[model samples]
Target: MRNQLPSSLHNGMMNYLSDLEWKQVLDSLQQGLCCCGANKYADWLHTPWIHVDFLRENSHTVLRYMRVDGRALPPVLPSSCCNPFSPTPCLHDPLQQQRSLSVWRDTPQTAIDTVFDKGCLDLILQPMVELLTAIPIVNGCCIALQLISGILLRYIYTSARNSVLVGDPGGKAYGWIFGRGDCRFALGSSLLDIDKKRAAKQKPSGNSGQESKEIGPRRHE
Candidate 1:
């Protein structure tokens, strides 16, 4: 991500004059980060955005003209590239070769000191590196937690099985932890034994009722 930042920033900056959102983004980065350009202020020299005109001379038609002398002006930096501490006017005439203290200049290091000389990429890269570094550590922690949970569930299943087979009370203790689900799950056979006893008692009562009916009919005859 860091290696590709300069070119990406450059392309984004190339749209600075034509796209309002791009202009705002670059302005925010320049002002908030207190840095200039992709690598240095000199990067703006090759950008086509400098020559693009915002004003259309007439309402119905679009028109473009060179500076007063019919010669193209030199590359100009945006007002956002000005240092907050500089008292001088931030705007710089593109045709002039002299550097202004208020604005970011070409060969920024040798200029009168006011504007930020560092690249915006350098200011932002460290935090991005730290964030990327933390992602794998978080994923590893999640995997470790999942493994531990799997081991714990297997242990519970084993304990519950043992209590059912060996008739140990420990499974009831496990049931307390799971709101009695473990007891119902482990003691399912005891419930089935109860149902069988109830069926047998009902069968004997039905046989007695049939015997009484046969005795009554013989007495009547």
Candidate 2:
């Protein structure tokens, strides 16, 4: 089926909805509409025509939760119930069975009143609104990071190209370093040469004086 989104939402707004937001929406939808005191399997099977009408009226929203393929969902059933009066002893669809199992497994002794409260649209909207509010911040950060990355990459490429062309007047040293060795080695070698010169300059003048004194004593002898 061709998935339809609201035209009111812009492409930029959609980017703010992460997988987490979609999951939350799905979870809220699965909660289903409030049974409104309809507890028994038979009660659910014989749900008021008005309630069904209400569901039909809001099918755009309700169908998303009920049916995967936009077809009518299988009837809800009790966990361990049988109707001997009916022709089919166990009229359970695999999908309905799985749903019933999950409901029972989660809350074995769920209260009748709490079993159904309200539709999940209210719950679903809470997260949606929060996500919408954060769009500006999230979008701004993403744009800023992209801009910074582009600028950094351009600067690096320009610097590398310039170093190979102009840094070494002969170009041979830069060409060798850029082609055969990495820029890191080129930069490290320069730092290493500076350190070697500093170490040579730091050699003790006292040591040279000591050598001269020993030579003078030997000459006097």
Report the alpha-carbon TM-score of model 1 versus the true structure: 0.54
Question: What are the models' TM-scores?
Answer: 0.54, 0.28
lDDT score, candidate 2, position 75: 42
Per-residue error (Å), model 2, residue 16: 34
Please list the C-alpha lDDT of all candidates, in the order they appear.
0.62, 0.40
lDDT string, candidate 2, 1-221, tens digits: 01222221112122222445533443333334322212233333333212233245363534534544343333443222333333432433223345444444465333222233332334435577788899999999999999888877766664556455444433322212232124434334453354356567878776788888877745434
**How many clashes (backbone N, Cα, C below 3 Å) per candidate?**
0, 0
lDDT of 1: 0.62
Q: On residues 1-221, what C-alpha lDDT tens digit does candidate 1 reach at each position?
A: 86688888988877887789989999999999988788876566555565435533342212222355433224456767878787654443333433442243444343424555667887889788888899999999999999888878866765566456545545431222232235466544343354356457657665788888877756434
Clashing pairs in 2: none
Q: Which portions of model 2 miss their true places by more than 4 Å?
A: 1-115, 165-221
Question: How well does candidate 2 match the true structure in TM-score terms?
Answer: 0.28
Total backbone collisions, model 2: 0
Question: What CA RMSD would you report for each candidate?
Answer: 15.6, 15.7
Worst 10-residue lDDT window, candidate 1: 172-181
Best by TM-score: 1
